[model samples]
Target: MAISSTLRSMGLIGRCFVHPIFDYLVIGGGLSLIVIPAVYLLADPPVMRDFTMLPWFILCSNSAHFAASTVRLYTKPGSRDALPFLTMVFPTVTLGVLTLCMFEADVIGRYVQLIYLSWSPYHYAAQAYGLAVMYCVRSGCELTQNQKRFLWWIAILPFFKVLLVATSKHVVAWHIPEQLVWSQVDWRGGVNLVTEVLGVLAMALPLVLFAQVWLTNRRSMPLISLLVIMTNGVWFVVFPLIDGFVWTTIFHGIQYLAIVMIFHVRDRVARPENKRGVVFHTICFYGMCLVLGYALFNCLPYGYQMLGFGAAESVLLVIAAINIHHFIVDGYIWKLGRGDANRRVVETVAIGTGA
Candidate 1:
């Protein structure tokens, strides 16, 4: 009887803004990254390299997630009035930059691709931090400024580690003549050691902070929040580079799609003018994202290929351009300021869920 009572209390502590299953499995990446890995480890399932080749998986993730934020921005009522510059000018500017990259594929395109790759880890870290704090606030787990600062470092430390290792080689290459890129190699070992230390700290600090928060606040952050932080750490630091990119893009897409859909539907339904049901809005929003994604990732690149760009370069440049645009747009659209509609929607959702 005591064990049963204790287990029930433990379960109640982990309550999420969404239902437990959906929030943990989808938004937190637990099912894909954590559960699947444990299953593979215990059962020793046959390793398949072509899992990403599935057609439905291809259509629903990656590019679809990138398209989601754009869909969210334009679909929200008053978006143009609220964010005139982003809604009006950014798309045209993005297209112009993409055209320049297409014309100078070797020079400008390379730099753009490099920027996307470099920025990706930091982007992931920021997403992790944002979602973690959102869950904390929504769950009524008040965090002091000191606690929030600790959480921020816990979220961002992985990015610092990734950045250090990534730039160490390139920093030397950038400063020296082209031919000396190969010869400059001595500094990497020390940087690698430093990153290794950072990696350990990044992996350890989250658990430490989680315990500290619980002790200090008399309430824990939602378990889903911790799952988010851990999953991001695994993506950047624990997984092999090739595997990390493949998995993170797909799973991160899943995470982004789930949260954005929730916010979009909630916002739409709450408006007095909205005549659409949640089901209708969800289907419509995701359907538009799918079509736009197909056009952006497939049709645009194929068009560039037909116009004489190298097929691989065409694909990569388009991806980089799209990603940079998404990163910039996401910066503005999700702000939680007093005037922002997102804050209202988020607070409403939290209250509705009894979070």
Candidate 2:
């Protein structure tokens, strides 16, 4: 209690961890991205083994948060305005078929995994960018068109490097040793050369973007924004391939839960359209995520195995397929257009008209 009181008295920099910036950058995914590896690096051998697999497995199974958010977005009345039945229905069927194809044909499954793995980095980066912009505006930063573009591109650049390098033989994620590179394009230089060049650009461009942010003063970069973006770069360096996947997914889940829950609560309170009481709705939202998370993340894979898809292989494919589905569903849902549920969610994070 004394320790927490000392912490509370530390003011904005300290308190920001729990408040306006919490969902946007600090605790949700961003802090864990740092703390997990720090502890893992400091632990002894036996402790390290516990760090290796168990935490990651638990985290991976917690993907129910993503499902919970996605389910709410779709389940809400009139969400279909932002996303049509065709958009939602087609991907559901197609991804399911693709999952089945993985059992039947190796090539199809590999591509499915490839797309999901490749998209994961970009997805993380994009979420960081969104939260960064929200916090930037909330904290009184005013961004012009060019400045926003620079920030956007810089936020995306690191993850883009992941996607580009992933096109060649390199660390993918999970148990897989190599990511799929496109077979068709023959570079005048070797593929390694292309990846090397991209890497350099990725490193240099963000610095340039930051300089521009400083120079123009159109919008000051929020401290939270910097932390969020920096965490992305550091996270990859700390855990390049294997444990990286687990840590990132967990962080992503926490981040998603924080922001989505905020939106859910806000929507329930602010909108007359909502019929359920705030406390009931909030409890239901979290309860669904906790229960559904296990079912989707743990049970679904076992269900696949029970159907004789080969336990090990089917579990892998099930995860890959679910991730792909999450990506597709999420990609369409978060646009900040005119009146709709998604717009409301994004608006809740805005200070003014958004930086």
lDDT of 1 by residue, 1-355 (tens): 5754443344334546467888988988886776557746876433434454655676698788999989989987678998999999999999887877788887666577767887777788889888888777676666799988888898988778766765532333345654554356666678778988887887888889888876666556677778898888887677655566667777889899988988888888888998989999889889999999989988999888898988877899999999999999888788877767778765764564533
Question: Model 2: per-residue lDDT, tens digit, 97-201?
Answer: 856675665656666666777888888878777766655554545567887777778677657656555543223333343422233345526755665565555
Once all C-alphas are superposed, what RMSD does model 1 give against the true structure?
3.9
Q: Give the Å error, residue 3, model 2.
A: 37
Clash totals, every prediction: 0, 2
Give me the runs in candidate 1 sitting further than 4 Å from their true place: 1-15, 35-52, 168-187, 349-355
RMSD of model 2 against the true structure: 7.2
lDDT of 1 at 291: 95
